[model samples]
Target: MRAFVFPGQGSQAVGMGVAIADASAAAREVFQEVDEALGQNLSRLMADGPADELTLTQNAQPAIMANAIATLRMLEKDGGVRLAAKADYVAGHSLGEYTALCAAGTFDLPTTARLLRLRGQAMQAAVPVGEGAMAALLGVDRDRAETIAGAAVDSILAERGPPLVCTVANDNDPGQVVISGHRAAIERAVALAKEMGAKRALLLPVSAPFHCPLMIDAATAMEAALLDTDLSAPLVPLFCNVDAVAIADPGAIRVALVAQVTGIVRWRESVLAMQAAGVTQVVEFGGKVLAPMVKRTAPDLAAISIVSPAEVEAFAKTL
Candidate 1:
């Protein structure tokens, strides 16, 4: 079986969807729709960038979604591929969840775009700048990383006051885990993790402390936005990031999405679950980032990254 996946924040680049948009009218329409929905020339920023502006949370969120959706449209219009017919399941990393839901037909493109815009804004506003920070703990398994995080929390509580909040933000793989919380605490964690045998611990250049309690405000905002929006049952099941489970019910998916704002992205577990479900091939739309992660996490699975019309055509041959 085949599983289609979308990429998250760091996958975005200047001129992301331009190739596909230029090659197919269907792809162009996706970009145009996103531009209109957001009431900005996001397409312009995406096509021509100073790089810094497009990398912001608000811009990167919807821009990445637009690129992925445009790639999907290119596969459909130019490569004669139909999502419902070609794929058995869909999934995405972090913010890419919204893009996956849209591709699976749970929500329209406009609603997805608007929802992502609000999500970005809410997440960005969740914590004050420089107060919270995230770091990647490399070459350590999840259990060890969790233990390190716990120790870091203890250290912080001993040094500061009670109510320490450091935690694992992402269990990416056996070799990579991300931790988030207070800046000083995270730095302490990085030092402690190295002592605990982690190969390296490096800070991430993110604007907010995502996937932590610090993002409770973002989660609350998402809950309100989700409640007001309409969600139809998806045509394909989604391997949710929060639960690492295949979810078909729109209501359940909505709840998971809201929780995911403050929940660790179980990307490693999600890919494992997909593998266990007999997904032999994984197709990553638009970006090449997730493909490498999939290969690293599950080397047995065949993975493809499609970013242009020619790549879409190549993928269609497999279908």
Candidate 2:
């Protein structure tokens, strides 16, 4: 069995999907539709970067979705591949969930693009700049990472510091977990990580701390937005980020999507679940990031990343 996965945020680059778009009209149409939906030429920003602007949450969210969907369309049109025919399941990291759903035909391209634009803006607006932060802890399991984060927050309260929050935002793998919350608490966690036996910890370059309680406002916004949007059942079950389980029901998908805003991304568990379900092959669309994580998390699976026409052609042959 095969599972198709989409990458989340940090996988985006200055010139993503250009070659594929240049080579396939199906890919270009995805980009063009996204631009029309968002009322901005995001493809231009993606191809010709003023890197800073392209990196903003609003831009990065839909831009990443566009790039991933374009790659999928390229694979389908140019390589004569079909996701529903070739893959047994679909899953994605954080924002990539929307992309996975879009690829599955649950949400049309335009609706997905607009929803992501709103999602990014809402998340960015949830917390004040510099007051929140995220950090990646290396060489620690999710359980230990959460304990360390709690220790950091406890230490702050012990000193009569303002009560702040610190929690593991993403359980990415056995070796890497990301924590997010108040800037002070997150910084404290990084400082205390090494002494607590974690190999290292460092702050991420993200503009907002995501997948934590600080994002409750974003979750609320998404709840409202999703209430008004049309969501069909996915062509395949999605192993969602928060639950780490496969869900085909639209209601469950909606709840998971909202809960994911303030819940830990159980990526390692999700991959394991897919493996347990007999997924022997994992194909990552548009970005190379997730394939390595899949390899590291589940070495028994054959993981492939297809971001160009040639890779698409080669992968299509296997199907």
Candidate 3:
């Protein structure tokens, strides 16, 4: 069986949708629709980035989803590939979970884009600038990363200061994990990582500390927004990032979306679970970042990302 996957925030880059959008009207329509929904020239920001603006949480979230959906549109309209017929399941990393739901027909493109815009805004507003941070620990598993996070927070508490948030954000793969929380705690975690057997730890360039308790406000915002949004069951099951399990119910997807705001993105476990469920091939749309991670997590699965127009055509031919 084959699983269709979408990439997360870090996969975005300047000029991400240019090739595919230029290649197919379907792709262009997806971009146009998203621009209309968000009331911003997001397509222009994506195609000709001032670099920093496109990287903003609000812009990056919808832009990433737009690029992925546009790429999928190209595959469908020009390549004669339909997701429901070709894909056995769908999954994505972090914000890409909404992309998965979009692909599976749970939410329309406009709703998906607007939801992402609000999600980004909410998450950014959840913490003050420079007060929270995220760090990536290389060559360490989730357990080691968690222990380091605990120690980082404990050390801070030992100083008689009030408790600060420090927790694992993403269990990305076997050798790479991300930690998030207070800036000081994250810095402390990085300082302790090497001594704790991690090869290296470096802070990410994100504006907010995501997937930690510090994002509780963001989670509350999403819960409110999701409650009012129209949702339908997806065409296929989704391997959720927070739970690392396949679920198809719309209500469950809603709860997961809210919970994922401050929950560890168990990407490694999700990939393994997809493999265990008999997914032998994984097709990643929009960006190439997640393909390598998939391979790293599930060596037995064949994974490929279709980003460029040529890659899209090649992938469709294989279908």
Q: Candidate 3, residues 1-319: lDDT per residue as tens digits?
A: 9999999888778888998888999999999999999999999999999889999999999999999999999999898888999999999999999999999999999999999999999999999999999999999999999899999989999997799999999999999999999999999999999999999999999999999999999999999999999899999999999899999999999999999999999999999999999999999999887889999998889999889999998888889
lDDT of 1 by residue, 100-185 (tens): 99999999999999999999999999998988999999999889988998998888788777756788888887699999887877
Cα error of candidate 3 at position 253, Å: 0.5
Which ten contiguous residues of candidate 3 have the minimum total lDDT?
7-16
> How well does candidate 1 match the true structure in TM-score terms?
0.98
Every candidate's lDDT = 0.91, 0.94, 0.94
- Candidate 2 structure quality by residue, lDDT tens digits, 172-289: 9889999999999999999999999899999999999999999999999999999998889999999999989999999999999999999999999999999999999999998998
RMSD of each: 1.1, 0.7, 0.7
Worst 10 residues of 1 by lDDT: 156-165
Q: Using Cα atoms with residue i matched to residue i, what is each candidate's TM-score against the true structure?
A: 0.98, 0.99, 0.99
Pairs in steric clash, model 2: none
